[model samples]
Target: MKKIPVMAAALSAALLSVVMLTTFSGCAKKPKLYLYNWTYYTPDSVLRQFEKENNCEIIYDTFASNEELYAKLLSGGTGYDLVFPSGDYVSIMIKQNMLEKIDKSKLSNLVNIDPMVLQKATYDPKMEYSVPYYFGAAGIAVNTARVPQYEKSWSIFGRSDLQGKMTMLDDMREVLGDALVHLGYSVNTANPAEIAAARDLVNSAWKPNLIKFDAEAFGKGFADEDFWVVQGYAEVVYEEISEEQKKNTAFFIPPEGGPAYIDSMCLLKGAKNVDLAYKFIDFIHRPEIYAEFTDYFGFPATANIPARQLKKVTPYYQAEELTNVELKDDMGENLTLYDDAWLTIRVGD
Candidate 1:
């Protein structure tokens, strides 16, 4: 057979290449819905199940604290679809117009959330901007094996005997709030004199015993026997300890009160997949589904009422201890006072 002319063959080849390119390009995957939240907030099994059921990819990222999460959202160009911010940050975000107002009707599983938690989310009082995820109080994690003499109290931080073996959270609010609690002042107090007095108490009482202020890995130090007592959230105690290590650990919320927080799932203004975001909120609220998260993380589920009935969850929330706990309020312009105070403490100035 005679070969086709060179020009004819070249034209055919170019057309074939175009067809192949179009076919492949049309099938290219789109960007996945992005979730920015606290480290270890979403369990591995929970994430895998959600992705499998939705038949969609989820891009997950983490920040260690609410302040970090807030700053990231404030920087803009985040393109995040969802974020888990505590109540106070939710309030701040709403004021800045960085969050998308949620359509309550879309949340079919809304009834699953405990009405009490919803009522307490003051940042979204109308329940129009966010949905409660998990709420817990900030407290102390004591390694009883290394230091058995301590009581279930915040006074552990002021114990001179534990000096160089104790750690307080690096979070300014938690440290300052504890100081406020110790001084018999409200954690949300904005009075200059009140804040000054609390600051002085922290500097004298907690500074000497504190080997370091660590929120990220104080648990590891506890496990390693480096820290005899450490300050952290109630959930952190459960998250970082192994079964063996747990035998020697005791978690406590001081008698006076501790800083309580409600972490809510908020929609970002840049969420490209609003419908799916709502679906996710509804999906995670199911009792059994929510139990998987609580059981794995070892904290009580606040928003999911049925989850509270689960054997694994019932033990975590002692209402008498946690019910009247103080939730951190959005300080707005008053945040500067906290920043300055934290800076001074960190520098020993």
Candidate 2:
């Protein structure tokens, strides 16, 4: 009788131990991801699809600007599995050691990315830490009907007649760089004298003619004909313009040159769910998903052959036209010169 009781107690204890182990294992297997990205950048349906297929919940967050996003990630100590940053910011983040080294072995769909984009990017020489998300050019959008006189050059922003009827980007680097390029200097010039000269040009131009120096509001102003000419992103203007207005609203690549930027996705260094992040990235790289993104976002994707085929079905695809688009190289420490020039332009002297 004593032996039987002891044997029964042991069996019960073993079963209890098994149950605990199984419960803990199940908890350990659930995957969760956190993503930080730009506002209105990704389609919610795509995110839903990812969640359904992977059985992982993705907490998506947005920032209005790259600088804001950088500041938050750097100072907040918030853990994000994935983030999207512009090409130049990627270089900055990598230098700060904030990004994780991507494991190519885990990313089978990485082959979908264009070799050219990977080769040309200055931030991730070998694309070690980031994947290209979108590419766009900065240019002038003018309402020809309002202006009557079409001006194609960058100098049009300085026209005296257009006083209080023009808007320029509030972005320090882009606006300053455009001014520098207008003066025939390198956009990435580090020479203090050169930057100062660029500042003078922009300051002198700002005087009574400037309507507002802004980024976000400028695009809407242009579309509404509140401004005759505005300096802004090509993609945003392209999407905002009505088919009728698009004919009258001309988009130009300044003869003097303008900024070209690439937005890319990167993994944070201390991310707890790195594997899940890679899985999510690979899922987006699939042809169908890429198509959906390009259709809604109206920017060029970096995926190579698949993107080419996907473009066929969507009006947003511009594969042939994208060939001529340029990309901004890392300006290195010269970025400070651009920022300083911007301040000088806005505040004078």
In order, what lDDT does every prediction score? 0.80, 0.77
Residues forming the 10-long window of minimal summed lDDT in candidate 2: 312-321
TM-scores, each model vs. reference: 0.86, 0.82
lDDT of 1 by residue, 312-332 (tens): 644333545666568889987
Q: Candidate 2's residue-wise lDDT over 242-306, tens digit each?
A: 87987787766666666667788799988998888998888878878887877766655555458
Look at candidate 2 and tell me the lDDT of residue 271.
92
The candidate scoring highest on lDDT is 1
User: Which prediction has the highest TM-score against the true structure?
Assistant: 1
Model 1 misplaced stretches (Cα beyond 4 Å)? 1-31, 234-240, 311-320
